[model samples]
Target: MSIEIFDGIFRYGAMTLLLLICVFLLRSHRSIWPGRLGASAALCTAAYLGCTVAEQDWVILLLLPACIANSVFVWMFGLSLLKERFRPGWPHWGLMVLILTTGLWRKFFADADQMIPVVLEWAHQFIIMGMALHLLWVAWSGRANDLIEARRRFRLYFIAFTPVTMIAIAVIDLWLTPDVAPYFLMALQSFSIWVFAMVILLQAVQLVPEVLFFPAVVLEKNLPNVVSAVDQIAARDLATLNAWIEARDGFFETGLTIRNLGDTIGIPEHRLRRLINSEIGFRNFNDFLNHHRIEEAQKRLLDPTLARLPILTIAMDLGYGSIGPFNRAFLERAGQTPSRFRLQMPPGSS
Candidate 1:
């Protein structure tokens, strides 16, 4: 029933400060859009903290204003990250305004004696859960950007702490009498401080230092970008051998050596070797050979016309030495056993 004697001002203030710093770091990448969302998140955090520290009735009025601004800003920031082509219009603004208005009403003037801030609490929960869900979707759907990656990493670091705090809150609310000091709340606050410290420590290793860490940073920043750069090299005019094309296109039956491929493509053997090893992101020639060959094997296995053929025949057709490695490669690429895939093929299919 009574506020704890310990001031929570420092905790909330520290969180607000850290979030604003993140927002500043994030704003450097505007086209990413999620960066702006992250900045808005920082603003909301600061607003929440400001509300927590307010002392007067006049100061308390600022809480609702802060909540309303944060709700609209956080929601718009979330929508911006969904990759839709069309910009949100008036209806979006109306819905956000409506949500913010209801939140403000609930927080500031719902009933005499401030009956309960139910709408405000629920709206805040909705925002937190919605943001978490969005990050989960981006992680699984392969649309994860750097901002999403940062959020995901932070979520992973802190998820284990949530249930302990929630259970503490619930137990206090239910079984414990109000007169009992909220000791568990203090414990939860301490626990969060530790979690925040751990998160910063872990994240520091991944951050790119502008001058010293550029090479490793570039690789870590985005795998797709590295893949794209290699693809560009492949597209350019290298004196590629006709044999290399044949090897890539499934022409070589046996004795498909790197030297032979280089001879056929007119590129020097060492150059061809380095291109595959360094640029193409594969370690060695055999692994490179298997990748393309397995790609062809996958197509054959999926083809209704080819499905009924003996698995061994498919293996031999793709230049594999035997059915065992062929099936392994197929399963690795397609995520299922070749036999299972064959059985699932439609009636009258290969």
Candidate 2:
């Protein structure tokens, strides 16, 4: 088959599949961000396909807008990882405007300047790749903090999809020569989109009970055996878990260490560490203690009877040697200092 014929077939086929995925996203009741992004991506893909099939010089102008759409798709995924409802702020708008301006200048003003277009395209691809990688890192690192099952699953899907798509595109753009058949690149792009679409479909299927009764079963299949083994340990150590929970309030002891606590509780320090880290989902010993201390502090801070008590007094009472550590921990968890939190609380709150 001729390269042009293959490219046409692949592009059209990909566009059709992308359109269906866009429609499915739009129909879903879930967050609209993904749908909007998918739609924009689909539109850009269609435009690029049109340009390729038509063999028109004017189609080169479409590259800039397509790049912007792709960037927005990546930006939206990043925002989804950080917040439930993300409105594009000044930085995002400024970056998009700057990219669009540069692309326009290259297409219109850089007459016969092959170097400028090449440079701009290279810069654009690198920026997109960097942003996608950063978002994937954020998703991977923040997964433990995400308590909502659906949102966590969505983040996982994005984490899995973004790096592969970005790396593949980077390789194709950097290494592929003009002499190479366009269908090869088209096929690679289509396959990546197909995989992403499949991920979304699987996520949607999780919403339907008949299609898959237990979504976690599928997720567990993908996870390492270490996680399940840890879960088993967490389940089996019920006595230690209960003892730790009952004695968690003692965590406020000044200069308390895991070894000292383990000695007092008659559990091995290493086992206690595992129980706290694996069972309780805390990554650090300090964080585990901080969580309990901060909870108690919050109660006292908002207590109507204790409203007149000084913040430092409460901090010291919570086993914190000084107010500074307590204040920082409270602020980290509550997004405000103890005094501010007390002031904001409704009067007469118990």
Candidate 3:
């Protein structure tokens, strides 16, 4: 049996599977933040695998963008999975450097045994593993804050699936040699991607978007319109929560946890979480708090009387531990930075 034929079968078969999954992800209105990233990742992964199996130089060159960007798309998709908005930081810049160096190494220093090639290969694996760990961290850290029942349950699986799968793939690529069957290696990588697409497929079901998305946060005024299945028990709980939180100033206290909020508000912590999610339309408790906080932040940013106060002071005053969360929340709500919002909008501008 020819190795070429073996590679041809598995590689082409995997590409077809990836393309089909890609089409499924993009069909209808499913192509949104995380799903869109997922589809792109699938396409990129297929392209990367295709280029690897291609014997021709032109094929490699033509598919190089998707090939190289596979990691980037996967990283971004992982960030989006938990439904919390992602803030780009040093890792993003580091990824760019890795991509640049990897491309340069492949183009100029084709020698496999060279110091630079070895270092580059190891660095690439490190980033892949690091990104997986990051995803694990995001899922674990955000689990308590997540509200959607499906998301809460999925956290455990995600924590296990993301890191192990990613690290395993990295290790397979890093440690395996040409002595091992190349088609087997390629088929294994392709299968890993297949599992990833299937996971995303599970999330993107139109009938149950809750599995994939952040709960829709709504203003108090719009709550009645947004809530669909409020029962008598939920209604009473909602009323109690509404009356209590408005009268209490402790909500403005920094580092307020949900347990503390529940205690002060005189509702069971679990019940409070449910009410906040089902009636008020928030998945994460912090997002609910930030909704109110950012509303006040918007007012403060536009308030001429408070103009003398600094943004940090305003943020700190609103119970944010620091400026970072404050800025992120402000941007999420106002669609711009506080400084920019203040600079651009007149005090009276709506």
Tell me, by lDDT, which candidate is best.
3
For model 2, the local distance difference test gives 0.61
Backbone clashes, each candidate:
9, 0, 0
Candidate 1 structure lDDT:
0.49
How high is the lDDT of residue 259 in model 3?
84
Please give the distance, in angstroms, between residue 15's alpha carbon in candidate 3 and its true position after superposition: 4.1
Better of 1 and 3 by TM-score: 3
| Residue 89 shift from truth in candidate 2, angstroms | 4.1
Q: Each candidate's lDDT (Cα)? A: 0.49, 0.61, 0.74
lDDT of 1 by residue, 266-338 (tens): 6666566556544544433554555567667666767887766888888787777777877766675567887
- Which of candidates 2 and 3 is the stronger one according to TM-score? 3
Q: How do these models rank on lDDT, best leading?
A: 3, 2, 1
- Which pairs in model 1 have colliding backbones? 240-265, 241-264, 241-265, 241-266, 242-264, 242-265, 304-350, 307-350, 308-350
Q: What is the lDDT of residue 100 in candidate 1?
A: 72
With candidate 2 superimposed using the best TM-score fit, by how many Å does residue 239's alpha carbon deviate from the native?
Answer: 12
* Model 2 lDDT per residue over 1-350, tens place: 76556555666766676666656655653345545655565556555445434545666555547744565565664564344334556877677777677656765787565788778767766776777777778777666544344555666777777666776665665556334746667666755655665554555445532211121111121121222244555555545556555566566678877678778777776676656554455444566666677777887877788877888888887788988878877887778888888887686664
